[model samples]
Target: MLFLVLLGFPVFILCYMLAAPVFGYLGDRYNRKIILGAGIFFWSGVTLSSSFISELYYWIFFLSRGLVGIGTASYSTIAPTIIADLFEEGKRTTMLSVFYIFIPVGSGLGYVLAAGMAGLTGDWHWAFRVSYSLSPMGLSHSLWSFVWSSLGLTAMAFVTGALGMWVPLFLYRAQLAQGTVSPCLQETCNSSNSLIFGGITVGTGMLGVIAGAEAARRLRKINNKADPLICATSMFISALCLYVALMVILIAFGELFLSVNWAVVTDILLYVVTPRRQSTAIALQILVSHLLGDAGSPYLIGITKNDCSPQWSFRSMQYSFVVCAFVGVFGGAFFLLTSLYIEEDRKEAEQTSPSSLNTSSSSLKEAIFRV
Candidate 1:
C-alpha cells in the first residue's frame, strides 16, 4: 500500500506534465469551454470507475490515476488562460486569488471527508463515490484559473514536494532524537499529525490568498508594474521563513508563509502575458514548473535520505529540506529579475491589443476626412 501510494503521485504528475503542452496548444486554437468541459467529464468518469475496481486488479487503479491526470491537465492548462482573458489588472488578481484559495481548501476538505466517510461506512470506497459525485458541480462552474509564475512554482514545488513527502518521518525522527517517547508511537498519532498539518495548511492558505490579492491590488494602485514586486517580495519572505523554520522548531509558521507565494506569482503571470498567448504561457509554466519541481523531488529526497550515513539517520531528511529552503531563495531571485522586465512586457502587450489598434485606425480615418 505504501509503495502504491508513493508511486501513484509521480505517475499522475508525469502524465500531467506530458499532456499539458498539447492541451495548452489546443486551448489556444479551439473553443476553450468545450475542451474544459470535456476534461472535467473525462476525469470525473474515470474517478467514478475507480470506485468499482476489484482488489485482485490493483494495477487498474494506477492506470486510472494516470488517465485522470491527463484529463486534469487539459483543464489546468486552459482554465487560467480563460480567466486571464476575462479580467484585467487588479480584478484579475482578485479573481485568481479566489480561484486558487479552493486548492488548499479542497485538499483539507478531501482529507476530512474521506476520513469521515470511511469512519461512518466502515468502507473506503464510499468516500471515493462521494467525491466522484461532486465533480459535476465543479465542472458546472465556468472553467477558471497558472504561469512566469512557473519559476516560483518550480521552486515552491521542490519545497512542498520534499517537505510533504518527508515531514511526518522528520517529526517521528525528532521524537526519537529528543529521547522523549510519546503517543506518536501509534498509527493514530500519525493521522493526528496529518490532520493538524492540514488544518494549518488550509487556514493559512486561505488567509494568504486573500491577503496577497489585496496587497497586490494596493501595490498596483501605486504602480502598474507592482505585481512582480509582490511576487518577488513574497517569495523572498517565504524563503526566509522556511530557513527559520528549518533552524528552529516552528514548522507551522513556515507553512503559513509559503501559502502566500502562489497568489502573488499567479497575479504576476496573468498581469504580464497577452490574452492571445495566455494559454501557451500557462502551458509552458506548468511544464517547466513540474518538470523541475515535484516530478523529481520525492525521488531526490529519498535518495538523499538513503545516501547519508547511519549516524545521521532521519536527520538526512532535514538536510534535504535545507536544500529546499535554498531553492526558495533561487526562486525569489528569479521573480526579482522578472520584475525588471514585466512592465515592458505588459506595455508591449497592451500596445498590440485589438482595441488599441482599432483606436489608431479611427484616428487615422478622422485625420484623412479632415484633410
Candidate 2:
C-alpha cells in the first residue's frame, strides 16, 4: 500500500505535466480534433496496459501509469483549445457545465465496473483486463477468467494515431493567422508589468478572504460596475449552503465524498472550459488538475502516513477532501464573479480602445478569464 501510494501519485503528476505541454503545442500548431483523437487513443491504451502486470514490478507499473498520464494530459490540453477555437466566450461556460456532468457518473461507474469484473472472474487481475477490453466498445464484456484491455486500447491507439496524421493543414494556417488578428496583440499575461502586478494581486488576494473582499471593494469603487465583493460573498454563502447539502446527502444517501467532489469539480471545469475549448478543453483541465491537485494530495497523505499512525494519517487525508469540496464551490463562484468583472472591464476598455479587442487572441483571453 505504501509503495503504491508513493509511486502512483508522483508519476501521475510528472507525466501529466510532461504531456500537457505537448498537447498544448499540438493544439496550437495543428487541428484540435486530431490532437484530441490521438490523446483518447493513447490514454485508453496505457490504461489497459496497467492491468497486465502480474507482479508488483514497481518500475514497469510506474512506466505504464506514466503512459496513462501522458495520454490523459494530451487530451485535456488539446480538447479545451479546440472548444475555444469553435465557440464564442459568452456561451462557453454553460457548454462546459454540460460537458463536466459526466465525470462523477463516469468515476462512479468505474468503481462498480472494477468490482463487478473482479467478482465475475474471482481475480483482481481480470478487472483491469476487462476495463481495457470494454473501453474500445464502451461496453461491459462477457465474463472471463483472464482478459486484457491493454491489447484493445493499443490497437485503437495505432488506428487513431495514424488517422490523426491526416488532419487538414488549413486549420493550422487559420489558427496561426487568427492569433495575429487582434486579441493576440494585447499584452501577454507573462509581460513584465503583468507578472509583477498579477503576482502581488493574486498573492494578497489568496492570503485571506478579507484581502480579496477589500480588493473587490476598491475595484467596485473605481468602476461602480465591478462586483468582486458580491462574487466573493456569493461564493462564501454558496459554499456554506453546499456544505449543508453535502452533509445531508452523505448522511441520507450514503454518497462518497470523493465521488461527489469529482463530480462537482469536473462540472465546474467543463462549464469554464467549454466555451473556449469544447471537448479538447476537458483534456487540458484534467492535466492541470491531476498534475497539481490529486498529485499533491496523495503525496501529502503519504508523508503524513509515514510519520504518524497509518489509520490516523489516512483519516486526516480523507478529511482534506471535505475542505477541498468547499474550496471547489468557493472557487467556482469566485471565478464567475471575476469573469463578470473582467467582462465589464473589457467592455469599458473596448469602448475607448476598440482596436485592443482585435489585437488579442480569444484563446489567450479565455485562458486568463478562466484561470
Residues 104-222 of candidate 2: C-alpha lDDT, one tens digit per residue: 33433444554455456756566567667765420112101001111111221221111111111112222233453233432221122223322322332223223333333355456
Q: What ranges in model 2 sit over 4 Å off?
A: 1-6, 87-95, 134-291, 301-322, 325-340, 344-371
Q: Least lDDT summed over 10 consecutive residues: which range in candidate 1?
A: 138-147
Model 1 C-alpha lDDT per residue in residues 215-282, reported as the tens digit of each score: 87887787865766666676778778877776654576666666666667765665455566667777
- What TM-score would candidate 2 get against the native? 0.52
For all predicted structures, in order, the TM-scores are 0.88, 0.52
Error of 2 at 33 (Å): 1.8
lDDT at residue 149 of model 2 (Cα atoms): 15
| Cα deviation of 179, candidate 2, in Å | 63
Cα RMSD of predicted structure 2: 21.8
User: Candidate 2, 9: how far from true, in Å?
Assistant: 3.1
Number of colliding residue pairs in each model: 0, 32
The per-model lDDT (C-alpha) reads 0.71, 0.41
